[model samples]
Structures are given as C-alpha cells and as structure tokens.
Target: MEKNKQPKLINPAELFDPGPYGFSHSIAVESPSTMCFISGQSGGVGENHVLADDFKTQVQDALKNLHIVLQSHSMTFENIVKITLLIVDHNQEKLEIWAEEARNVWKSSFLPTSTLIPVSQLALPGMLFEIDAIAVKQLAN
Candidate 1:
C-alpha cells in the first residue's frame, strides 16, 4: 500500500468536529483482503531497550514502529483501518503534541479511525506513548 492510498473517511456533517481536532469520526473498510493486527508499539528504541522521554519524539517512535510492522506486509499508513493510542501522563499539551504529529503523518489525506486512551502507566516503565493498529490489503488474484 502507498502512503496515500484511498481509504474511506467517515465523518458525517451532523457529527461533532473530528478532523479539525486531528481525527476522523470513523473509517470504513471494504473487505476481501488480508487483515493484520499489530500489537501495542511503544516508544522504546529497538535494541537499546529505552524509551524516548519527550512526548513528541515518543509519538514519532511509536509510529515508526507501526510502519515497520505494516511494511512487512507491503502496507503503509494508508492501509491502517483503525488505531488505538495509549498515553501516559495525559494532558492537553501532550494531546496537542500527539495530534500535531498525527496530522503531520497523514497530511490532509484520509486518516484511520482512532481511539485515544489516557492511562497512568504502560507495559514498561518510562513508556510515554503506545499505539496499536489494524490494517488490510486487497489480495492479488
């Protein structure tokens, strides 16, 4: 999948604002393809066994990790159908940073539906951000 692949973005006019706030109301996926689920990816630096301290960097690290998993199946960010974000030490500033990074990653194109969760802690100490995603790609005949 290309980073700019066309995926359905569902945000009804009647619904509350989502895009302006860095998320879509929902993402609709057309099936008949292989599905992939990535486990929660944190900001841990691979092979270094350490997590990034800053919120923005941590968010980017998680996305990079997610990209690695998606690429293994020939998919890209556009292949993502849904995402769940876990943020430790949740706050407006942290959310703003996360949203900004998300907008940067997707640009103005469609975005996968996302769920944000505020938590007191994560699977590992010092993990500030984590993300898990679901993706799908059409099977070649």
Candidate 2:
C-alpha cells in the first residue's frame, strides 16, 4: 500500500459546510486498498495510566496517541477516511475545543468522515475523550 494515496472527500453543496464541525459528509476509498482500523485511544498514559483532569488536555493527548499509531504505519492525518469521537460530557464548549484541535491537525484540507458520540463515561474511569480511526492506503498490483 502506498502512503500517498488519499480517499476522496465529499461534501454536498446543498448541505452546510461541515468543516467547522470537524468532519466531512463522506469519503470514497479506491479499490485494491488496505484499511487500518485503530482502536479507541484515550489520554491515559505511562505505567499508571493516568488521565488529565482537564478535558482539553485529554483531547490533546488522545490526538497525540492517535498520531503515534498512524506514524507506526507510515500514514498521516490525510490518509484517514473515518474517525469516531467519544466525549464523556459532550457540550458546545467541548465541541468547539475538539473542532479546533482537529483543524489544527488537518489544516485546510478536507477533513475525514467523523461521528461524535456523547457518552456518560468511557472504558477508563478518568478518561474524558477518546478517538478511533480508519485509514486507507492503495495497494500496488
């Protein structure tokens, strides 16, 4: 699979621009491709697996962890086709923070397809935010 291959991002003209919401309406992946499914990553780190007390901090750490996994496979944010975000206490303020962080990572390019879920709690006690992704790379014949 080639690292440079990117999925086609689509956003209908009739629908409102989703960039501010931190996602695209859909992404089209070409055939003969390999997909990497990453499990949900949270802010907890180190041997003790401690989560940050602040929501924004946890969001930042979670993204850093996601980047680590992507780099392991030689993929970047542009290669990501889909992502699912889980927020412990989803709100407008937190949404804004998450969107800002996402924009910082993706820049001006079309963002990946995303689904944000508001959850009462996460797998870990102190965890406040989690993100998982699906990335694609074209396979050579």
Candidate 3:
C-alpha cells in the first residue's frame, strides 16, 4: 500500500504570490495525522562537528542534516509542513542564498511554510545557519 501524502496547499485571493521566492504564503493541514516537531538542526558534520564557513555552504549542509533526520522517521521533504530558519548576521545576500537552497531541496510547488529569524548568535560559535521543521507522516488505516 502507498503512504498518505502531506496536506494540500492553499493560496487564496488578495495575497501577493510568493512563487518567485520559492515558497507558499501558507499551508493548511486538515486531516488526521502525526505531526512531528523537530529540534533545531545546524550545519555541522562529522565527529568534530566542523561548521561551514560561507552562507551558501552552511545553508546546504543544514538542509542536508534536516533531510537525514526526516529520513530516519520514514519521511521526506514532502512530509515537512513548516520550517523555521535561524540565521546569524542575516542580510539580503544570505536570504537569497537561503531561498536558493530551499528551491534546490523541495519541488517548485512543494515549498513548506517557513519563517526566517535573524539572530545575533547561536548555541555554538561559527554557526551561521540553523533550521528546524514540523513534519507530518500520515498514519495508516
């Protein structure tokens, strides 16, 4: 049997289209399913946990880590309903890099609802980007 998919997205009238930015304005979940709130995931790998230096690399690594977590739970990017992004020293360039990374992850129409937060610092030094997600893997009958 096939698994149930994520909720349907709704883009109603009177709102500016967010397509160019590779995200939807909102996501609506109306069915019975299991929602998972993932903790913040940062862009670090290996035993030493070395972080990426540049903005783009950090964003990519962060998303890769998030992917690993989702895969462990039998989920994928489609299972993600919302994403909260935290970035230190954020600027328009960083935002563009982030949007590019996001576009590279999810399909053109499957961008999860997201919120970008600019923070002064993170739990660790040299941490440029951190991301957490809310995913729903629909329960079977």
- Where does model 2 exceed 4 Å of error? 1-31
Question: How many steric overlaps are in each model, in order?
Answer: 0, 0, 0
- lDDT tens string, model 3, 1-141? 124556444332333343654654334343567566666767776545578887788788877777766665567899898999999999999999988888888875977899999999997799999898888877787
lDDT of 2 by residue, 64-122 (tens): 77776676556788888899999988999999999899998998576899999999999
Model 1 lDDT, residue 94, Cα: 94
Residue 102, candidate 2: C-alpha displacement in angstroms? 0.2
What is candidate 1's lDDT per residue for 1-103, written digit by digit as tens?
A: 5445445554434333444546643343444576776667777665554677788888998887767666666678888889999999899999899989888
lDDT scores for all predictions?
Answer: 0.74, 0.77, 0.73
Q: Estimate each model's TM-score.
A: 0.74, 0.75, 0.75
Model 3 misplaced regions, further than 4 Å: 1-32
If both were scored by lDDT, which would come out higher, candidate 2 or candidate 3? Answer: 2
Model 1 CA deviation exceeding 4 Å by range: 1-31
**Clash list (residue pairs), candidate 2:** none
lDDT of 1: 0.74
Q: What TM-score number comes out for model 1? A: 0.74
Question: Which model, 1 or 2, shows the larger TM-score?
Answer: 2
